[model samples]
Target: MAGLSRPLETELTFPVRTYDIDFAGIVSNIVYVRWLEDLRVRMLERFYPIEPLLARGEGPLLARTEIEYLRPVRFGSTVRGIMWAAGHGRAVFDLQADFEVAGETVARARQRGVFVHYGRMQVMPLPKELRSQMESAPASSRQQGG
Candidate 1:
């Protein structure tokens, strides 16, 4: 574990739009879901692109999602979200994210997903390429320890 590189984290930012707020002037719960979806898409786009997976007729599907609001996000606030592939099993891949406003945590979310064969509707194992990328350090970020 000491020698293994940390998992790749994908960070993104979102502004609290007027449409994202509720009558109470706080971000709606559904908006968090949308942001989570965006995080997942960006994660894929940054790492293993979705185009190839879709072309192969296999792609990840969200099996479950859980989000906890720690603080209210008001309008004019920008949320910074950082997500990473927490871990994976034979078929299930887990992702974790934290949304922070001005360096303070506003919410935390987790997503459980699985890859499936489109036509057959069968589960597929996690791709080695993805696993390796997540486990290896980024070339630019890798630094020798003293």
Candidate 2:
């Protein structure tokens, strides 16, 4: 698989477990959503740990997701999941992810998420420290060599 070169991309490899497969013997659609969530967490952990975010009573909450299923992934398939911050507004940002199996794209998803004040349950801007780090992070931080 080609290494992602996007300015804020993260890639992680996973194997399709038996439970991930559906009655059709292909990986279940819901499993991809879980994979995308994992990628999102990994991306956030790169710049800011969840502990600090929680300490500030902030939470990254998913607002919406749009996914397209291309090819079916079978059990035991090795998939490389890729995610990146496509864009952001004041309190909401867009994330894009691709699930590739054996060099073929199996699925793609776009997600919108918001930073919210946990207690207030209201949207909030991303942490300034995290925003700065994300904006100025080195290229190495963007691409993980597979």
Candidate 3:
């Protein structure tokens, strides 16, 4: 049996640029997923620098992802991106992301990833140190609707 899991939290703020808007004048659906992906990578980098992981010949790889858009964000709006690890087991970790504007959540996402030994290209357990780092971090602020 796997031990209890904790969520790792991170927050990011950025302005919606013209390039991210769609024909309807709101953020494109695809862009939301992109933002979620960026947030996940950034969160990992903040807790465990990716460069060092690469040097160690081990890195996390996205195994699957899902996104749900609750609202649209228009160009010029300031949006906040938050990410967290939802669960962790022997070989995989589930991550979640939320996008917000003015304290209102605009979107949410989930991703499952596996730690891999790069050279061998094999799935591996998340390092104990990395898991401890996640467990020790405080949870992110909850969105108005979340």
Candidate 4:
């Protein structure tokens, strides 16, 4: 979340739904988790389709999430979320994401997790195709934040 940031690879816009509002009349913190899920799915689809992963009984498992809320987001406001892959290890992968309103960041988050074989309940290496995509990309364009 602090070291580096890069161009967004998967960007999506969302309407701040009524149900997202808290008693304080602002978007609740829990809503950000939903948005993060959406962002992650989009990122996966862009680099590696979920269908293939699921077919192989492989899926990502989130181990942790850290969010920094920078500003209040109110209901009815439009939010633009940008997600990118930050780094990878033998099995763990890092993701960074930000929520923007009118070009200003309202929140940012970092997620660290790994892909696992569902039936075996074991960790799997980052998909080769997805890893190749990142390796073949220019540094500036490599999926950097999710």
Candidate 5:
């Protein structure tokens, strides 16, 4: 398993949309959660598309999430979300992310997850192929083409 894991990181940048703001005039707390979810999906797309995972009868499910909002993000501000896998053990894994605007981190988050067998809802071991990709991907390589 050691040969198949690493501190894999990636990021995505998007402008804050009108709907992302709350009545308080800043991006809503839930919007940051959505951004983190999107980041995870994009990471999967880069390393392991969902279609194949589903075909294998396995998929990841969130078991926990933790976030600390450092600053409010305003409408039209371009925020970059950086996500990375922090660690894993057998069927469970951990991920971390940060939301930044103009290089200043506005929020930081962590997620705990488990890969489950689709039909049985039983925890499954992390796949070696996925682990190999994670272990080999260069941290400096920002996922290209969105």
Candidate 6:
């Protein structure tokens, strides 16, 4: 399968474990969502420095998430997690992710997160610094030559 490229994205790799699989020997639905979330957070930390941004009382918080399972992921399979910002608005941004095994897509997910003030817990615009940093970061391995 061909890899899809997007701007300002990150890819993480993991091996499917026996525990991640269901009785049918395929990855459980819940595990797929968790993996997607893990990759999304990793991308945020890698490119946007979410920990520091949160420490400063500013960062994006997950507001909603949706997942679509396209194929089965079996135990012992090596999976790749690809994550990137799909869209951004004044207060909310959409993070998109895909799980693939042997270059075949198993699932896709999208998370809508909003920048919020920690103290007030109110939605806020993404900081210019964070946005700029994310925008400047490399989007996909295809472009960077993995």
The true-versus-predicted C-alpha distance at residue 145 of model 5, in Å, is: 36
Candidates 2 and 6 compared: the better one by lDDT is 2
Ranked candidates, highest lDDT first: 1, 4, 5, 2, 3, 6
TM-scores of the candidates in the order shown: 0.86, 0.86, 0.82, 0.85, 0.84, 0.82
| Candidate 3 per-residue lDDT over residues 64-146, each given as its tens digit | 88888898789889998888777666677777877889989888898878889999999888888776665543434221111
Residue 62: error of model 1 in Å?
Answer: 0.6
Deviation in Å, model 5, residue 61 alpha carbon:
0.6
Question: What is the C-alpha local distance difference test score of each model?
Answer: 0.81, 0.79, 0.77, 0.81, 0.80, 0.74
Model 2 poorest 10 in a row by lDDT = 137-146
lDDT of 5: 0.80
**Model 5, range 1-146, lDDT digits (tens) per residue?**
12323456667887999999999999999998899998999889877788988987889999999999999899989998888887666667678898889989999998988889979998887778665655544545323221
Model 5, runs deviating above 4 Å: 1-6, 135-146
Compare candidates 3 and 6 on TM-score and give the better one: 3
Residue 49 of model 3: what lDDT? 76
lDDT of model number 3: 0.77
**Residue 145 in candidate 6, Cα distance off native in Å:** 34
lDDT of 1 by residue, 105-131 (tens): 999998888888989999888777886
Error of 6 at 106 (Å): 1.3
* Candidate 2 Cα misplacement greater than 4 A, ranges: 1-3, 133-146
Indicate the TM-score of model 6.
0.82
Global CA lDDT of candidate 4, please?
A: 0.81
Range of the 10 consecutive residues with the lowest summed lDDT in candidate 4: 136-145
Q: Using TM-score as the measure, which candidate wins?
A: 1
In the range 21-79, model 2's lDDT, one tens digit per residue, is 99999988999889998998898887567887798888889989999999988887899
Clashes of each: 0, 0, 0, 4, 0, 2
Error at 33, model 5, angstroms: 1.1
